[model samples]
Target: QLDDDLVSALKGALSGSLEALILGLMKSTAQYDASELKASMKGLGTDEETLIEIVCSRNNEELAEIKRVYRDMFKKDLEKDVAGDTSGNFAKLLLALVQTRRDEPSNVVDYEKIDEDARALYEAGVKRKGTDVVTWIEIMSQRSVPHLQKVFERYKSYSPYDMKESIRKEVKGDLEKSFLTLVECFENRQLYFASRLNEAMKSKGAKEKVVTRIIVSRCEVDLIKIRTEFKKHFKRSLYQTITEHTKGDYQKALLSLCGGDD
Candidate 1:
């Protein structure tokens, strides 16, 4: 940590240039996410799905930073805002996710535990008449990614269909969508992004916001893999798809981030 003298000196230096100070503050990814989250909640209709997706997908470290950033930027608690805006089981799930308490990814995998969870999932959803959403939520939310990977792999053997297809058949509404997204992302984030990009492009009028968000968010992380997945799954390059679907400065900016295809 900086000493008080250095801190004061740095603050004084930054205070002299308003533009520089603003730019420096805007450079933080956590702050950017916090700002976006706040904006999503500000409108006449809340972007509830986006809020849930972001909170659920982010791991403990990222969510902790997000909470700090949210407080710094909004002078309000993220959890409280979420609670005020949402209700019922969905709200509870989002609240649980924002706690940032997912089990850390584990290298060691227990085959028996995986089998048990897989069986539990099958019994909770498909094997019975009514679905056990609480069981599904608890299992999906609490498990490590590695463990979930194994659980999904083992689930196929226990069930007639793949996990995604099973989820499609067994679950419905927002919970279903969230679980499917989580399963897809845990299996392959790049492919999930490619699918999102494809959906954005294929829809009527195009989903520019989704496309921009994915490209900007993943450009530094795995845009190359996303491009590859786009090609592999869709039989067309992400660049070509973006070129066809978007126009003007937005298209150019997204293309620059997309770079080249596989």
Candidate 2:
């Protein structure tokens, strides 16, 4: 039930990626793990399992270790291998991820880059959610939180607006806030989400979509922190919030997202 729009967007990214790229990868990679390949054949193999696992699992501290070993084992840069095996939108998105590396802290940020990012995000998420999510996920999951914060702060400054208010002012529809919250939470787990949720519960009706967005997108990555955010910000337990606003599959999913910690 993804609908025609979502299907079309995903297909567009697949087509642009070049069949040769996918076909070449589908042949020898045998599950995207480049680690098993000999140094001479590294570029010829896909190694996606190792790559994506590291991308999805490693925080900044661990990612450097993975990067070091990947380069040492392959005898070539990890970036180069990725470039060789992927193309088009998929390549563009994945390269953005591999290049940025992590969300580590930075001394300064460029505001203009944020505008470009906003443009890219608008094009990807609002205009086309399917393929765009792939791209965004690669970048967001790959980059570290500190790096993402710079982009988030810069984005806020460039637009000169808070995401919640901005959404209220500029965008309409239930999903916009959800998407914005995803960007916010991904950017600064400690600051963005808990603050907003607390503010929402106190000042306005708590929006279920905001809670849903964070739970669905980030629960696996940082549920304990999220529960803390809910407690600290709203001054109400997260479980209480869950009971008030949700039930059934969504609630089950959220509880599951806490990953059995609760």
Candidate 3:
């Protein structure tokens, strides 16, 4: 662990985006996630995109740790904070996820349950007149990734559109965004992150916080795979994209975290 005085000195020495990145790096993964969550909800308006991305992408254990750390760091309950900040079904979905009740991934796949869930989702959305947001929220927030993957595959046989398309058709606003993000993370987390990174830099002005969060959070996890996916999808390397969008020490720090060009 870094010493408290040393960490404070480094915090005092650094300024701007570089300080955010460096300080982010010093914390444990759960602590970083907790801080990011707090930062997203701080101030007048909430950053719904950041909240969605972080909440939707994390797994059961990771979320449990984040919720615990969030309370410790902020002296507040993560679930209550989410409920207070968001509204409607979006808040329901986020609160469900923050409960950390998702089943663990296992070698054993329950094909029967998969088919049942696929049917449930299909009936709830495409087959019915009105969408059942509750059913969607329950399945999406509680199922294991591997189970959901199989469910999505089976769902294609029942509905005209895939799960993501179905989500787009069924819901609107932040709820839709959260569901889609969850589906993408389920399908291919690294690829989803690569797409997010590309989107962050592709805008007129780069979304620096999104870029920093993705890079810093994923650096030790699957950044190399994300780089590969970035090149494959965008026809440009993430390193070059960072060079074009950011400047000075911020760019340098990002590039170092990115590891290398694809």
Expressed as tens digits, the lDDT of each residue in 79-122 for candidate 3 is: 99998899989999999999988888988878899999999999
* Stretches > 4 Å off in candidate 2: 1-50, 56-61, 101-116, 123-262
Clashing pairs in 1: none
lDDT tens digits, residue span 49-143, model 2: 32432343334443444456666655677667666775554445445555645545556664565566655544544445343555454545554
Question: Best to worst by TM-score, what's the order?
Answer: 3, 1, 2
Clashing pairs for model 2 are: 32-47, 32-48, 32-49, 33-47, 33-48, 34-47, 102-144, 103-143, 103-144, 103-147
> Which regions of candidate 1 fall more than 4 Å away from where they truly are?
1-27
Better of 2 and 3 by lDDT: 3
Write out the backbone clash pairs for model 3.
none
* TM of each candidate vs. truth: 0.83, 0.34, 0.94
Between prediction 1 and prediction 3, which has the larger TM-score? 3
What CA RMSD would candidate 1 show? 6.6
Predicted structure 3: lDDT:
0.92
Candidate closest to the true structure, highest TM-score: 3
